[model samples]
Target: MGFADYPFTSRYQTIDGHRLHYIDEGQGPTLLFLHGNPTSSYLWRNVIKPLRDRYRCVAPDLIGFGRSDKPELDYRFLTHYHYIREFVAALDLKDVTLVLHDWGGPIGFRLAQQEPRRVARLCFMETFPFTFDWEEFPLAARPLFFAFRRQRLSYWLLQRHNLFVDLVLRLSTFRPLPRSVMAAYRAPFPDARSRYPIRVFPGELPINDRDTEAHRAIEEIERGLAGMPQPMLLLHFHPGAVLGRSRVAWLAQRLPDLEVVDGGRGLHYVPEDRPERIAEALEDWLRRRLPEPVRGALPAARVAAEDDRFGGALTWTFADTEHGGMVAAWSSHGLVMLSFAEDVDDGRAQLARRFPKASLEAADQGAIANLLAAPAATPLHLVGTPFQRAVWRALLEIPPGQTRHYGELAHALRSQARAVGSAVGSNRIALLVPCHRVVPRAGGLGGYHWGVARKKALLAAEGVKEP
Candidate 1:
């Protein structure tokens, strides 16, 4: 499809004296699409067109790519991060749903973390922000790595021979890209000299803590994500035969709220193969995360009456009532504060302490108890930092019967196994949310809030065939 035929309205904005190219279309809630290395807003062409009518889609070509200006400034993390912040500010976007892929993860993630209230949800695909050890890099990337480190030599070769754009397009995909797509990607690099950022990107990958330029920026972004509570969706692509699926699984475990979708192309560029899926996932998440308008306010008495029913043992009695489910109750008060006891007296005392002034009474709310006793079909709400939220959201997407290791979830969350485990442990609503489904790398039952026995029982109940 030709670029002109697309439904988007093209425009440019001046951010910090540089002209930045962007596409805005549709008219409902706002959706910001951030591009990764060697690609521009054009990467989201397919996504924008389909979603325009229902959403206001804004995809910006990072400062150096597409129609944006290629200034002679250092193309470091801070520079890009500042440019994105300026671009969003210039446009005055609010309550945005961010779609990030590849390097877009850090760029978009930083923006969300900086202004958490403005970002309702996030959709991450085939990207990482935590850390990627060089040992995990694919064999094909070794040459690219070596070329990047030899900055002077690499720049000379890429710019002199006009190989940067061509090589990127060629190696970015497992399947061959069409002539038109190739043209679109390479169109920005009219000459080798204009491809400085392309050369700089690979060189900037933090191989160690010594690379303070990019490493510190990434670490800061990781810290931000660890605490963000916005809902996150993780698209776990196949890393490659060498990396294995375990890495992605590790990410899911650490991120208590992640909703991982399968069938992505690979680590290099998932956007090229599954742009629509990523866009749709973002759309759905936006709908869920953004608060809806209350339809006609209820009278205080009515609200109080309802609260009263849910106040004490009365809450147990209404367990099966319209809004009296245990999950619903915990969802409102937060899981950390809710308590359950073996005896009625103990439970009553706990409830009194938990909700001091709220009335306390008891009734047999069997249905709510049953619901909690059963495996959850509804996904759990994982509360944590933005990165942890992203990781947890990815975890939620792991199919009900399937299990992934801590390391696999880490790779998907773009963090480490240890970080993933910490997030998993932070998961509030346990059984109903299914944090129990996550296991260890060695195929043993990992830790669970309720207990390992309960975790195993829940997993078995969900039809997980124990090995």
Candidate 2:
């Protein structure tokens, strides 16, 4: 709805002669988010935004939904499954963390079963993990679901009035959506003709043990549930549409390695209702269970000769800026260290300790002042462990006028706040790496090596107002 909220680049892939729209953001381990009927990739915007800086988040619009082309197919369960299977193959994604909801559960579960090695873990909300007998379905939802199966009436309501987007969607959410959000969901199915897939979705539900193709397909997919144990997480809420209390209990009994968290209050559209809860749960679970592989340790020979790699006399200089007095140093490679210092002699001693192997020389103060003014312009000879280097790189991505919570940065990096704080504290490059932009999530300016006052002053200079 609002580009400010869902600000991600749209991408496309041609699969099965149709242009399938998707959003692929960030880089690292993959988090492939799949949406059910009515909702599209837009369903995951808020969830994706917080995690994208650390993990690669990919959400695709199904062939007949959202920005994807609407081909005139039967839009049956298997048909949608086949398209999604092809879509995954086309992308060649590996070791994926599948985040599914509603119909997405069936599609993603089937894919995971077919290729277990490719899928790393699974997290779902209000998903269809098994076939539902009429009694198993939520009592409140039965009437509308029954109406959806009554061929002619379903067509009249779903297609003619677009009831799925209008009535059903509105009623499903615990909270009322803004007009603009409703419009975004409505944008996909503009007319009756374009609503064919929406009309077909209801009939695809495997209900009442009926002798139908959908039931048979779901039966086959359900058969693999007990065995598909890849660290599953169930983010359930009170009185969800199909995934109610009884059904959740049934699922817990079947799915192994299962961890359940109450996602506060929500209805069918939990993403819209509790996106922050979803994001936090997912970030915590993923960090604990599927931690990113640590970069390999360097060989002994290389570690011994680390200083020789950047062999040359390092130069140092000091500058008095509006914020405070600053000490800056540069090696032949680039700016090696920069920090705010009250005492010039003590700062010099600290610099020597940081680079004990290199010879220190005096440099022009003007050159160091210009580098401080435009930090990004100068190259940096960052010396730290692989993880610390990663934290430094993440620090550079923070926009000048913005600040990130330590926990937020930690989650983004799939690490704990203490670990992130250690990495941030170790940063020697100061303004060039922008470690001062990090703050405590609980609302306070966190500790700064230079001083909290200097951090405040630096932020104020960049137009960032602290809460």
Candidate 3:
């Protein structure tokens, strides 16, 4: 097997009287791999190897693909979705980042919609999440769709000849796969009876038709993108197989929080062509957003879906505001810094000065704004003296529409008022830790590190009058 160098643990779950097989390896939060037609979890070997150090990798053979049971049941999109959903539930996979491709897009996204709490982030490639009419289909891809829908032809080709694994993937992939790799792909379905899932995927695609369940799945994805939001990344090649230039743009418009990246010159099977690129993108996004690998089991009963926004480390994002511009950052570590009214470069520089040696990345403006607008429950990573950290924590306890004086805070911490003021000024992260809630004991508003005017505006926004 190709996985000799990167051996993975074999795991299985019985779902719907079929033995669904999957590979579970590594440690920390799970990264679930969902394969499309003709390919199994074996498609993700390259991707899993690189990221196993930081992530727990779970790649499943979707009942009819790899080592999983290929039941005689009709393998429809809904059937696959149910199997995958039950698989996730059975394993209790939480705080998940779905790495999806091909049919996996509809299956994964639809699952996210059904169980909104289960998924945290999504990474997709060559997978369409929106519905399209026949006219919208690419001219080159049109024939393939027509061919797939021809039931007798598709069945003979897919089930009898295994044309998809033998020919289609070979043609779409950028480079020729090794003989061993091809064997791995074909290993599961040596005969027609074993290829039912692959046989079902193509016809299930909603082309020029709306009534199809798969079509409804795409529409559901559209609604899911609108109603609920999470970090998403769309990966595509230059001359795309599925997501051409116009289609990517359409997807961008639909998913405003999406992070777009090029997966180089590849066709639909991006995992085969650009595994490293996908790995790098996943690493960069997960590192910035996740910040740290999960060190231990999450406390019991804490549903991973609960804090799906970003991990507990300090994650930062850049945005433009009426007040010049903003470089807002957060992580599992709460709002570390919000440097407003500064040029992007200057803001990042200021952040560097405040927390030197911290990893920072420029996040999508729209995505960061959504997070900042509705702050998540994350602990602050305050790099200050014990007294200063205590002061910041106390300030966070201050209710909105109320203000605390330096003397009052000092009395609470049993420290000098001057020292408390100095600590407040030293507080690097703003808004989240609520340093602005601390005011002066005298009959005047105290100075603020960001600015007195901004401070006043914050107090006003919180419905607090300077007392």
TM-score of each: 0.62, 0.63, 0.67
The best candidate by TM-score is 3
Candidate 3 residue-wise lDDT at 182: 83
- Model 2 TM-score, 2 decimals: 0.63
Write candidate 3's Cα lDDT for 80-127 as tens digits.
888999999999886688999988888898887777567767889988
Off-target runs (Cα >4 Å) in candidate 3 are: 1-6, 291-432, 435-467
lDDT of 3 at 302: 25
Model 3 per-residue lDDT at 425: 88
lDDT of 2 by residue, 62-117 (tens): 88999999988998888888888888888988668899998999999888888665
Global lDDT of each candidate:
0.64, 0.80, 0.74
Q: How close is candidate 1 to the true structure, as a TM-score?
A: 0.62
Q: Candidate 3 has which clashing residue pairs, if any?
A: 311-332, 312-332, 312-333, 313-331, 313-332, 313-333, 315-330, 315-331, 316-329
Candidate 3 lDDT for residue 235: 83
Clash tally, candidates in order: 42, 0, 9
- Specify the highest-lDDT model's number: 2
TM-score of 3: 0.67
